[model samples]
Target: MATTALPAPKSGSAVTVRRILAIIGVGFLVFFAFIEIVPFVLTVANSFKCLPAVQAAPQAFIPLPPFGISCQTETGSVRSATEMTDGIAFNPTTEGYQEVLRQNLGKWFVNTAVFAIWVTVLRLLFDSLAGYALARIKFPGNRLLFFIMLGTMMIPGVVLLIPRFIILKQLGMLNTYQGFILTLAADAFGVFLMKQFFESIPGEIEEAAQVDGASRLTMFFRIVLPMATPALTALAIFSFQGTWNNFMDALIILGGNPDLFNLPLGLALLRGAYGDTLRWHTFLAGSVITTLPLAIIFFVFQRYFVEGVSYSGLKG
Candidate 1:
């Protein structure tokens, strides 16, 4: 007697497993997105709420009506609702923003901008020159000099704080914008980065230029630098960001002079003055303002950032 043929295993199981995995991946993405966005959302929400509402219901993103509802304080006493509106959940308030502006936030912004721009530009020029000389120019003890520069990179920046301060004081540069700008302009990393990029470029390009009667300066400016646009752009972005976000350097160098303060220093001062009573909305507003320029620069020159990372052998 012929046995009944067994049915083949269903192929649908494999497809079902893949679908489940895809769903799980999408779920993970959604979760991370929420995590990233929650702080900004909370900040925006709380910013609109009156001070009392924010303190009363710190976790409550939505503004609840005054309905005689009250919250207990540390003193175990119930306090009446002071300020809140039920119209919009998260409305924008210019109070915090206005305070920032009133306190010369514009000046801090300008200070940061000027420092970032000058440092970036000067670093590009000087670093490229030094890098080129080290990479191609044959001179006595060139290797030793390159090694010395590299060694400086290994030294912790914090360790140099006192020494740098002393030198600046000796030069009478403390509390001056020139001091801040010039110190950052002379960057070792920039030189090292440019040197690596220059090394990767074929020597044949420079040799050919020299063959055509181009002077060394002409070859560097016209031929080498032009081709190094990708590396240069990357360096510029890095230098700008470093100078803009720099806190300790600014604090140590600029001291207590609010007039010379950068955004970071100013924000720190705000936090110190406000402390626990600091308005979250104002803090967030200041954060938004401070972050805007870097965001713009990064987005605009994003291509260069990518090239710089990948081509310069620098990891994120």
Candidate 2:
């Protein structure tokens, strides 16, 4: 019988190496997920528990009680061991929510919303306009202007604090909404982002519009701007988040007026006045309320925001 040479034995080492790598990758992902998820889970769980329960034993998963807190059992309601011990009962209370609201959370919410909306809208318009002009319009010092704008972005934002404050003071805009909104309404990064997105659109589209007797302004507003929705959406979301979370600038510009405090400023005020003895539940509740709008906005527009970031490669 002709002994056909049997194929060389497969390298078991290679298969073993791949298995090790696969195991490592899975382990890393599980570890990373655990790290990321634990805090959010803890926050949600703690939000449901009463102050004493959280303080007494924050690590506890089930609500302990004299408060009679228990989830529905398979055979109707069942009291947990925790429920029987504490004469206090476990139940969801809106006291935290009520306290946040009663403490002028509504005003802070409205202030943040207004600031974010105005800054976003204005930044979108101005940045896109400047970007389009820099990208497409030929004018004296155009390149220089673009370079200056780019250079401005490189300057640390913290460095601008004193200078910006001085300028605002000189301009008599201190403590005004205009001061806060306009301070960040035309960011260099936003302009740069818009410029890059505008550049990505083939010049052919704008040329065709021009050939059809469309004015530059008309083509930009009606044609280019409409098609740049992804970038604009991303810029808007960024602007909103930045303005909403703005604390230092608002604090410095608006002074210590409680009436003028934004969400972050207001939150900080709670801690400053009450110190560590402050109601942890109330503070967390306010945080939850403050975060909800941004979370909703992000989820709703996440696709566009992600697309814009990917396409722009802003850092790169």
Candidate 3:
């Protein structure tokens, strides 16, 4: 009977405020989701529309025929025709996709795939070897070299474009795959990423391998490298995406070589530059095709991506 009085029921205004905040939070989430999803939806929808339909109502969610009537003379009398909403006119066509293939989109796809694969593979191997040496092997000037490489990252990428072009031209590599791939074989960022991750591995593991009479190469390949799957996956994804979407470098290096044009370069060439008006429908279709590979890669590797984001390689 003497127990403290039960707390009073929450005030109506307080309950109302909580409800309002919850509603507001949900509304914000929905709004942002809509913002992100709408453009993708519009692109896919419009990709199926004919040029005339897209021009008529670019903002329309559905790729239906434009609201207009067609007139033609029949039996010496004028007749009118209108496409109903549910008519065959609303059906989508594969013309854009067909045209893209005819214009060597498939060749571009293969070129981009091969280029990205080589970049990812070679970048990983070279970066990992350099990172392991810098992190684990004690060599004169190792720290200085790493710091110098890091300093390279601070240089604006644009500043290097002219210099890189000149270097490639001097080597007679311009307009070749070697010109494109060699310059990007290994980047400072990848080396830096691998170094940090390698440093996180316990030295005891390498020491154990040494005690077992393992050579440095054996220790790295058989022992240390096996524990670095997460970091390797992350690096591979980064390299692939960067190389796949590369535009300016590909444009310059592969200059005017239609056979070597990647998706980005091919998409750029898709635009029709007659006096002023742009061919938007065809452009959107090509964009959809180009985006599919990236989307697939991300979805396949999303688990590694998540781990990479939160990975603190070194446990403090």
Per-model lDDT: 0.77, 0.79, 0.77
> Per-candidate TM vs. native?
0.80, 0.85, 0.83
**Tens digits of per-residue lDDT for model 3, 53-80:** 5544324454454433222234543221
Q: What is the number of residue pairs that collide in model 1? A: 0
Comparison by TM-score, 2 against 3, better one: 2
Any idea what lDDT model 1 has?
Answer: 0.77
Residue 66 of model 2 has an lDDT of 37
Model 2, residue 58: C-alpha shift (Å) = 5.3
Candidate of highest lDDT = 2
lDDT of 3: 0.77
- Could you tell me which 10 consecutive residues in candidate 1 have the lowest summed lDDT? 1-10
Residue-wise C-alpha lDDT for candidate 2, range 1-316, written one tens digit per residue = 1222355436888567766877898899999999998776555545555455445442554444334243333576533325322433345444556667899999989989999999999999999999999999899999999999999989997888899899999999988888998898899999999898788788998898889999999999999999988788888888988999998899888865677789999998888889768776577778888888988988898887687667667456
Candidate 1 clashing pairs? none
Per-residue lDDT over 1-316 for candidate 1, one digit per residue giving the tens place of the 0 to 100 score: 1222345435788557766877898899999999998876666565544345554543446544443232344576533234343434332345557666887889999998998899989999999999988988899998898899989989998998898798989999999999988888868788888888798899998899899999999999998999988778888888989999998888888965899999999999878988777776567667878988887888898888777768656532
